[model samples]
Target: MSLINRLLLLLLACAAPLPATPSDLPLKVGLIGLDTSHVIAFTGLLNDKDNPSHVPGATVTAAYRGGSVDIPASINRVRGFTTTLTEKYGVRIYEDIAKMCEEVDAILLTSLDGRTHLEQVRPVLAAGKPVFIDKPVAGSLKDAVKIFQLAEDAGVPCFSSSSLRWYPGVVEVATADFGELRAALSYGPATSEPHHPSLFWYGIHAAEALFTVMGPGCQSVVATESSGAIVVTGKWNNERIGTLHGIRDGKTSFKVTAFGTKAIVEQKSGGNYAPMLREIVKFFQTGKPPVPAKLTLELYAFMEAADESVRQGGTPISIPDYLRRHGQTR
Candidate 1:
């Protein structure tokens, strides 16, 4: 079907009847992320009275993310910020970090990426609580395993994902049982910031979608010889695949194709945000994480292999070492 024709059908399906709210839902959430910036999406979902459905039975009365570092700012500045968030967005802000985690049933780490996530997530893990960590759980491989393994040892339900995992078309293609796989290519855009850890930052986004469709445990990675545009290729289960062209200018996009002995199927997706939030909420309802701690561990390993390959004059890097050595074998 044509793109516009497909979208029209999607619009009709989306217009289907909305369901009534279930009463036995979980209560309260403690959000941890920088206030008023990128992580604002969580605040928008939970506190924005305008979005009543997401906030029902869920009150982020305690907000602890970026504002905490600046001590005076955390105390004095937050009151004013909370006023705006509450009055304008209806999100209640709490000053106490320990108190917030203790009081709320679960925690949402809104500041999804970078070095700070390790420190921020530490407090949550230390408390022995379930967490919905945003993507790129950690910038480096060691830290990612440390954080995730800590959660595993603590026996807490820690989860993370890009809404890309929930792309309707992608889900359909992956589930159709397309005979034997051959090769696949997936890709998306990136900022002009090349060496700014951009690969570690965003490449995993396309990686997540690729791994989800093909099933994880990707081994032996090679980078683009000329562009070094963070392109990666490897084997997923029994199939050979590639992730194309990051750090380019264009609308963000991802695709998954299964080349089978019998038939070929492809799925293209552009939006991945709402589905991510929906998955987190679903984990809230059911105590199972969509992506397990071990799966996230392998994701980190995949990116680490990319780094190793880039450093070794773009030689293909094997994924048998590092966290793969200590990774869960179960």
Candidate 2:
């Protein structure tokens, strides 16, 4: 080749756009449910460029309007939120989840009703997409266990968690340099849903925060109810005690008090969803769950055991026996 031609070729190669790097290409994300306000908050954070708290690694490109008619909370606001997703954020709506899965790289199972999560996630797992299930992984413990097993069998990464787990204060309580954590107390609003256990709905926030401070090995759970709240006490493996107070009446908020050998600290401040969204984005990018499936299953088991305790008149329920009865050895 002539020198001039070679120089021209080199210039063109240099000027041509480099193949997009992984960091340059954002992952395409799909939403499985539109009933909850999380759809709006999450979409705005992920899709709206002007939003102050926008998370940049992924964009919500598609969604499925999955709502339960039996639950007023699920059915009433789904339409409005669906409209907002389409009109405000320009996200495509898919009537079928599998089809949406075909288009997006990852799935966010945000359905307000936990019962639908198992069935909805089946198609997502079939497509081999990484999924992040919102709180209450399933309506029941058995279903939650099965969901994780299915994802594991499929070799697809999956996880479920409450945003409170990543709250600044909660993280501090969980990871501070204080002497070993001896006990913890987490309290928050836990309104009961007739379809779900009392703690599965809103109380998962506090429950998750509790587990954050005291990493999972709850051997026993006992719950008692009063007019004001339903209190659950858990015994960890190392004799570390953790308590979750599910407020039923009057003013309610999330707080965690950690009792360490060196000092005691309480987190009364609140946080927004942005921190958790960042973790979700990172999980989608890496195809790794921020929270392990086994740990999440154990958390659900803890909540289910609380229900069993109430059923047995506040008798302490054994976590191992509870998991074995539900066909979950792990």
Candidate 3:
């Protein structure tokens, strides 16, 4: 080749845009349900560029409207949420989840009804896409176990968690500020949803916060209930005691007091969804779950055991026995 031609080729190569790397390419995310406020909160943080805490590298490209027709909270607001996602954010709405799955690299199962989570996640798992299931992984403990089992069988990494688990104040309780957590007491609103267990709906937030401070391995659970509140005590394998107070009436708040070997930390402040969204984006990029499937199942089992304890008139329920009865030996 002539020297001039070689110099021109080099110039063109240098001027040409470099091929986009995996990190440079934004990940297309699909939303499976639009009934809850999380749809807006998460989409706004991820899709909006103007937000100061906006997380880049992932966008809600498509969404499927799957709302519970029987639940007024879900049915009455889904249409409005759908419209907002379409008109305000320019997100594509699809009638079928499979079609939406085809266009996105990751999935967020945000359906308000836990009863539908198992079926809703089946196709996504089959497609081998990483998924993040919102709180109340399933309506029943058996189904929760099945959902995790299916994901494992398909070799797809998936996780379910409450935003409270990653709250800044709650997260700090496990750090050096509160060295070696020995016991914790958490309280939050626990509104009951007809289709789901008492704690599975709103109490999961506080229960998750409890587990966050006290790590898993809850051996047994016992509960005592009044007209407006229920207190559940979980005994961990290491003899650590954690309690979750679910308040159904009057003013409610989320607070956790952790007693550690070094110091006692009281976490009264709650954080928004942005912190959790950052983890979700990272998980999607790496194809790894921020929260392990086993730990999530254990959290659900703790709630289920709490329900059983209530059913048995304040009797203690064994976590392992509860898991066994639900056909979840692992």
TM-score of every candidate relative to the true structure? 0.77, 0.94, 0.94
Per model, state how many residue pairs clash. 2, 0, 0
lDDT at position 269, candidate 2: 67
Task: For candidate 1, give the lDDT.
Answer: 0.64
Candidate 3, residues 40-155, lDDT tens digits: the string is: 99999999999988988899999999998899998888999999999999999999988888999999999999999999999999888999999889999999999999988899
lDDT for model 2:
0.90
Clashing pairs in 1: 33-65, 34-66
Q: lDDT for every model?
A: 0.64, 0.90, 0.90
Candidate 1 lDDT by residue in tens digits, 1-330: 999999999999999977755445445677775433434556566555676535444445556645544334233454455555566654555565566778777787765334556788777777766788776676576777777777777777888776577778767767767776666566765442232255666666667766776676676777653443567777665655645455445466667666666778788445535566667766776668988777777766776677677778778777766565645444
TM-score of model 3 (CA atoms): 0.94
Q: Give the Å error, residue 293, model 2.
A: 1.6
Segments in model 2 whose C-alpha atoms lie over 4 Å from true places: 1-23
Please report the TM-score between candidate 2 and the true structure.
Answer: 0.94
Model 3: residues with Cα > 4 Å off, grouped in runs? 1-19
